[model samples]
Target: MVTYFEATLAQLSVHRVGNKGLNEFYSLSDNTLRIEDETLRRLLMQYFLSPFEKAYEVFRFTHSSDDLNLNELFHFSSMIFDDQSAFHNLSGQITKHLFNISNHPKIKSGELYIATFRDIQLEGELVDAIGIFKSETKESYLKVNPEEGGFALSYEEDAINITKLDKGCLIFNSEKEEGYKVIVIDQTNRTDAAYWKDEFLQLKIRNDSFNKTNITLGVCKDFITNKIDEDFEISKADKIDLLNKSMKYFKEKGSFNLDEFSEEVIGNPKAIESFKNFSREYNEEFDAGLDQPFDISGAAVKKQAKVFKSILKLDKNFHIYIHGNKDLIEKGFDEDKSMNFYKVYFKEEQ
Candidate 1:
């Protein structure tokens, strides 16, 4: 949760980074941008910070060699954090580093903005943060104004939309030794080599309650939706019931215990054993460090609950939403009409 209602853009340095594989060049700004307009500063703040409001998973900068000094971005950002006077020079070095790594042809060349913020509210504390943003795409806007009793229209090309931030990251200055708490957004080049996050920032997901809860919910959904059907004869309603039960357990309990969840949600011994096997495979395949008997994150549950769909689609005609007891729903076949149907039992029609 990041809030910037009272934040001030202390310094900004803009630079142009081009694709290295295409033989393009990068240009650096000589000095920090002096933004005198309050309106523009507010809009810039909104553009850079709003996308992080829903970003729950935190990350920290990492290096393969396990040395922070080898990570150029981390070293440069540390320098900037240590001495504000070196911001512009360090931003130039950051731009050069990005240019060196932008060798992939698919990477777009855009203006890179290195900004420093003050008084940002993060988890109830007002901390200063460093922001790095790049604008890869632009939109065309038409402008119409009155010209001597007549309306004249003009168009501007290559305009950055303030609402859509292409790529950005906020580095809060709280955790210095552990590679300051970071949150990132990458709306462009997702399928490419992950140059923004992996190559440039070299970030690794922080191991915390949010990640644990998120990974556990993901594995549970995968097992219930995809894996269980292979071993057992289960109907759509039964699957929905299982999903509902899983959601109920997470919502009711403050922490997660693997054995307890399996016993409660998946009662059958065979099914519980199958679920454990699948969980192990999932954890190994994705390197999800799922800790047993860890606290569950309510925020993670709220975010993941959206994908636990309960809708059962039938042919082109009807859809059934199963949220409760599976016993109430009965599957039947009509020989006369040569069709199948579900007989739903309910107390009253809503």
Candidate 2:
């Protein structure tokens, strides 16, 4: 299991600065910038610089500049950056923000580069990226031969390697449900990019209320899809109808009422009894408190909308959507038939 750290940015400052030696690859003019925010800088050092080490993962923004009108300097995105203009702007912004973080303990006096590329191959995909790099050195002992005697150890500092990049943020221009998503790495000595890239960065981030909604919705989905199916001998059609009804209840209402939902969704007394047991098990299994009321997550419903469908593929000819009114569709068998026939009725065929 991965542990998530909480961070609070107190204040921030942004400024434009001249690029010292980053003009060759970036093609950026003196329009580069440096930001100075002590609280944010300390947070970055504590959370990221104090963690493991690895080269920063780059994500390109794929959205057009027209869709990237964002007023907030720090916006969250679900996707990665794949656009040149967007990635460049994002890199410039990151460099400026990182400039003001001078007094942090872990972040020594060093040069931070915002390198840009037209298209680079990452994870088998050719995309644009703005690489964030920091230049620092580690203390090392160099052996030197003295004219009078044997070799003596000389103290020297070696350039810090990119193998363990502990503190940096790769802000991609790609827009997600929130804003532009960034791959933030805070590795100290241990390098584990996969955990940060594949798992942590992929999580949905928003306000507390938004997160509560998604968590609640996710719990419901898991319970219906896994728990209910395991213990009960309910048909697929009934399950789908029940799921649709539950989703409808969540969407139409402001909050979730446990007892009311159990009565209305399941309807059967025995099933409600079974669901209570399932609810207990579900809470334990998923670490959720579904017995309490929570505001529904509209964003989560929109995101998980496709997964809630119940489809029937008939000989690859027609796909049926049995989302509601399970009684309207009858399941019948044909003699020596490999598949069951479904008699569907609709008020309007359209």
Measured by TM-score, the strongest candidate is 1
- Residue lDDT tens for model 2, 223-273: 677777676787767777877887788778777777888888878887787
TM-score for each prediction? 0.94, 0.44
Candidate 2, residue 83: CA error in Å?
A: 33
lDDT of 2: 0.51
Worst 10-residue lDDT window for candidate 2 reads 1-10
Please identify model 1 stretches exceeding 4 Å from their true place. Answer: 148-150, 284-287
| Candidate 1 per-residue lDDT over residues 177-223, each given as its tens digit | 88788999998646794989999999988878898898899889999
